[model samples]
Target: MGYLKNIAIAVLALSLFTFVVLFGQLPALRKTPLGTLQRALCLHLPNGLRSVDSRVTGGNITSKSRRLGQYLFYEQNPVVLILFLFLLTGSAALFLWNALHRLPMSLIVPLPIVLIPPYWFTYLCATDTDHYITPANHQDRLRDYPYDHVLFRPGAICKTCNLVKPARSKHCSLCGHCVAKCDHHCPWVNNCLGRGNYSFFLALLLTLGVLQLYGAYLSYWILKPYLVTDATRSLPWREYLPELGDAMVEAVNMGGLSIAGVGLLAASTAALPLGLFAYHCYLIWAGMTTNETQKWADWRDDIADGGVFKTSREALLSHSRPRSPEGANGAASTGLAVHLGVTEEEPQVRWPISSAQVIVRTNDGRPPRGQETLWTQIWSLSDVDNLYDLGGWDNLMEVLNGR
Candidate 1:
């Protein structure tokens, strides 16, 4: 039943993909006003079908052109296409075979398959905001009917969400909740990186960016027009315009130019991922996340007090703060509170920082000028009669105790 369910889901996914790609979105490429006239005069072929002349709807040359192009390409391109299909099908089969045979599915297989597809599509169909394009003009209403007044702002943050929000907060529509310092929910990671997993998420994105750029380089070269005849190349854009008129000619020319321009456009698009990767790297070195970066930019003056490091140290120590609140022993809360917060932000001490720095700040701030005895502080802090001091690492226990 499990195997059957997987097969059913896979088939449904593939069928839906085919329907959407073949008949839904891609076919509209041929119905453009420019494409319509091109097909009328049989000037160029539509993308999927091959010939524009043959598929003419109104007994026009456009139909004939589409048909002719489709036929010519189909017959000639069969060998190349069949080889691609065979490889793709074979790979799928091999994957299924391993799965069915109870082979130890390594983490490697699903990682790339899951991560790359969404990322590739994200890059491929990216719009101005590095988000997926809304099909048709679905979101055009938001743009066309601009709200200039104060009432326009959709303040989605509720009271509960407001208090929990630290800095760089955003509401995830899919998750239907406000996340603290949210970056993006990544399916490949299989974990929503709010505050806990953010650093690792940044690292993953950096690694993916490198992998994708390398792949795009290889795919770009392979798609370069190697077998094009000069007849195809020599036909100037101007010459085609005279025969097909401005619109049809432009369509025909674009159809051809698109074949060549893909690599150049891809190279240009490469800059986005590269630039993002570099920006994040800079943030990591500066001990910041996307959230922190935004906050730093928004309130640069607040950092003047040198509170950032102090606050980070406080948050780091918050977890292990001594909880002996006026016990029977009444030991003068000899426990020193590390004032890590530099600025006035209340929860700034709860923010994330490196573990090493956390320990250092909690143990001793600016180790005493000469008597820099780390063990002295450790022994003092760990020396409660009823308490167990599981603090030292390995044989360092004797060394710390002796101090």
Candidate 2:
């Protein structure tokens, strides 16, 4: 009973912590209680801790502690990756060792085989070095995608890299380099998922999810006979809470506790990767990256607040030209342009689809009023074209091909 209680407490606590860490900062949940709790945990709690530490150590400990926290959480480190691998390997090893003699040949053959792909793909993604954009290849990288003028615009340069920022590229502070078509940096893989490694990352997620579900199923299979043999003593299924306690006890008596625990862990954690994979699939279908989706969500909020306005893409493109005579530059040349009184540049890369509208934001809530035909008020995102979207099938191909 004590062991069961301890395990349950530990699992619940870990699940809660993971939930807060994962979904706390999501834009969709920003206004919800979960978001507020996340802010409190991430921001307010840290500040409070720092304040207490400052008082305790006369300000000696605050900065160091903050740096440690940043390095552990925000920066690239192998701690989480090591922990993930340890958990995966440890659980699988323990389960297989315990069940080796009892398990059938068919189950034994495929169990280890299922793990191979995720490990291989994870290694490939972690070691793949093709995503980084350097000064030597920055010119060629610019041709990968065109700026949509909403989330990404031409003429912007990365100050750190001192190169023209390509559409969908972002400078990863941890990597200290710009990655093309940057997805979020994943600490679990200890790698940045970008244009080069995104397919492998997806494959890793899918395979890992399968591995976890398989682990859970095997665990259940091993425990089922034991559970059935003790049916007279087993509590009713309708009373799940009490029945769970009885089940745990039966598992321990049958020498299946470790396997049962692994199943619980697998079942609990499997949802995370499967959910993430589904969300990424949605992003691929929508022709967006995680970064771009966040930007679009922000734009949607701004539009709702009446801070966003739009103009015809053709009207803006007419005044802008390629930045260089060589036609290699996508940035707009220095010249007065009508939209927002800022010079706009034509996209260097010829995108598959063209933007129907150019969207801009004003600091004040007032809409931009001018040539009514050119500058029209956009009420929603549907009013503008998603230049990245070439339909779901093509977008999936683009991600898979790493273009």
Candidate 3:
């Protein structure tokens, strides 16, 4: 029953996640103009497969055929749908299986590969003005504005960096820098997925899928192949010396037998990446972000504020509800103490969730020293728990100090 319950949960989670990626997020991501780099990437594909080719290239039903093809690939390609389901589910299974094996988070590298689907989808879905504006057009637009004060440029603007955001660019508050064409923050990859290393991400995902799928395939009726092969080699020895030829010895031989294993491995490795890229191509046409497609609803808006949609502060407050101590379990007590460790001693952290402000105070009730990390300031001001526990405090120390 326990095993069955786990399996059921796994299936449900994969199904829910996949549904959101295909339906919810793709549509909104398509609004951005295509960038030159993205365009170049698309152009490298076969003419028959390119998104705009049906419109640009010549054919017998040139216009009509192109439109039909476009609709099929973008709106309703059966292969794409099937492949999407397989890849998404397979990727999830692989991740979960590895997680269950007690693998360390740092060593479980397959997640980087699985993470590619969403990032690629996000990139393909981006249709902002950055891709639409050309150098010539920028020159024309600049002709009308004062040269010194003109801030709006061709690319997306990075508000924090105070510079033009390139294709796939994103701002990371922790890093205090803007990434060009950012994919996502990946702890497993231990690097930001951006324009520079996107292809690598794709490669990694495909490789992971291959490795995982192969393992899955090996689990079903796998013993049969080994059993039959082992029987053939051991018959003479077993017949001659039944006492010595034990089941254990046969089992070891069977495990070691190579028997077309390399071929299977090769096929899996090749198929995994090819399959991912192909599915991603379809997602691009659909114009969806992985997060958007899976949920249809705003995750940031739906959950606690610090998630995908909400700003750091909004997420902290929106999700904060007083934890109940009535249960009185030992494990629960320990968890509660850890969660409230920084906050319990502080009082100044009680602030409105919507505000981007922080209340500064010292334990001794004196002003904090200058040149502190936001974390240090917050810790000094109030006795907060983890920095994430509150809304008004941007730095962790504010959360710890509760100021």
Q: Which number leads on lDDT?
A: 2
Estimate, for each residue in 228-332, the C-alpha lDDT of model 3 and write its tens digit.
Answer: 444456567646344233432443344332312322332334443455456554433433223223432232222223211111222222223244332223343
**Model 2 deviation from the true structure expressed as Cα RMSD, one decimal place:** 5.1
Candidate 1 has what TM-score? 0.29
Residue 400 alpha-carbon offset, candidate 2, angstroms: 1.7
Ranking by TM-score: 2, 1, 3
* C-alpha root-mean-square deviation, each candidate: 23.6, 5.1, 23.0
Among the numbered candidates, top TM-score falls to: 2
Write down the lDDT of every candidate, Cα atoms only: 0.35, 0.77, 0.37
Off by over 4 Å in 2: 1-13, 59-62, 230-244, 317-350, 367-373
Better of 1 and 2 by TM-score: 2
lDDT for each residue of candidate 2 in 12-128, tens digit (9 for 90 to 100) = 888777787778777777889988889998899978888888899977788887688698768989888888889888888888788778778888899767878878987898888
* Poorest lDDT segment (10 consecutive residues) of candidate 3: 144-153
Better of 1 and 3 by lDDT: 3
Q: Ten consecutive residues with minimal summed lDDT in candidate 1?
A: 381-390
Clashes of 3: 43
Candidate 1 on 203-263: residue-level lDDT in tens? 4445455544543343333333332434445678766433333332333234233322322
